[model samples]
Target: MQQMQVYARVITQLIASEDHTVQDLNSAISAVLRLNNINKSESPQHLKRVAHYSRLIATNCADTYSLSEEWIEHLYLFAPLHDIGKVFLPEKLLTKPGPLSPQEFERMKTHTLKGRDIIDHMIDSFGYKDHLHYTGMLRNIVTHHHETIDGKGYPYGLKGDEIPLEARIVAVADILDAMLTKRVYKEAWSMDKTLKELQKLSGSKLEPEFIGILASHKQELMNIRTASAE
Candidate 1:
């Protein structure tokens, strides 16, 4: 218990500080999650890659949309936590080799709210008043990352501008990574196929503007994917 408290303190400090490097903070968070055996099937490197892609998408969207640099930085830092909800999923579901049963799928979907609950609990316990902006944004992003632009997404079926831009950016990054990365139940799709699919989803499943940014920077995004693999 004492050791756990010490570690929690360190994590809280790292997250709250503006000057802490994102790489260091992410490393610490991943370490804790790994120690808890939450990521039994997925490689830690996969999460790192997703983080990279999400940040890239966020940065690109920020530039294209004329968002403040500070806002973009916050989005980049909080984007990884979008899937931190997966930590709440049972290892069996997370590592399952076959497609999930409807019941299992429903259970898996709760990770979004579960992640929000976890962050909310942390804020309540730690009294992280000032970090509210970052934490609040992250919580929303985590809960809504799976949501689509056309109201097909789960949890809340927000459409178009109804979804926050941060969530919209993450939705694109998340889908891209999921499609390109090999998984237990399916083989990886080619980048061309993945981009084509994303294009198909534009205006309906994804924001057209965000998709445009992704389309324009296809090579850079691929480089992030390749570099993270090594």
Candidate 2:
């Protein structure tokens, strides 16, 4: 309990301190997750890649999305936190060897809402008051990222543009990385295969525009993978 209080204080310091840089924020996120026992083998790299992919898509589609530089940077910072609630889930559930049972899947779906609650609790408890500014974007990314474009997603059936732009962007980033990375239940898919899979999901499960934007930056994505690989 005392250690948790210390962690909470560190989070407060990281958020409220003006001297803290992005790297500091990243390190704090990593340390927190490590303490919580996420999949140490792949979680960090997955987070880094999603952050990079999100920033890449946001920067490339800036004019269309009306994304400012500040927004893009914040997306990179918060993208990793999108799955923070996974720490609240069980290890067996997270690393299940195959398809989730119906009950398990329902439980899994709660992570998004749980993530939102965690962020809110942290902000309220620690008084991070718009930490780095635009904290709502973080909440949006954490909560709505799972909502599909076709109104088929969980927690809320938010459809079409009803989903926040930040959430859409994070969703695309997340799906791309998840498809490319090998997990306990699946092998790492080839980049070509991953793109094809994303293409299939473009209109229904994900925003098509961001997927197209991601596809256009294949080379840079490769560089990101190389740099962020576990």
| Best candidate (score: TM-score) | 2
**Per-candidate TM vs. native?**
0.88, 0.92
lDDT string for model 2 (108-151, tens) is 89888877776666677776765547668877988998999999
Q: What TM-score does model 2 achieve against the real structure?
A: 0.92
Candidate 2 Cα lDDT to native: 0.81
- How far residue 32's Cα lies from its native spot in candidate 2, in Å, is 0.7
Cα-based lDDT at residue 25, candidate 1: 70
In model 2, the runs with Cα more than 4 Å from the true position are 1-10, 40-42, 130-132
**Residues 1-230, candidate 1, lDDT per residue (tens digit)?**
34345434544665787876878877876776775445675566666766677677777666567888777778877776676667656788888989899999999889788766666656766888565566767778878988887798878888877787888887887788878888888888988898899899998898887777778888987888877772
lDDT of each: 0.75, 0.81
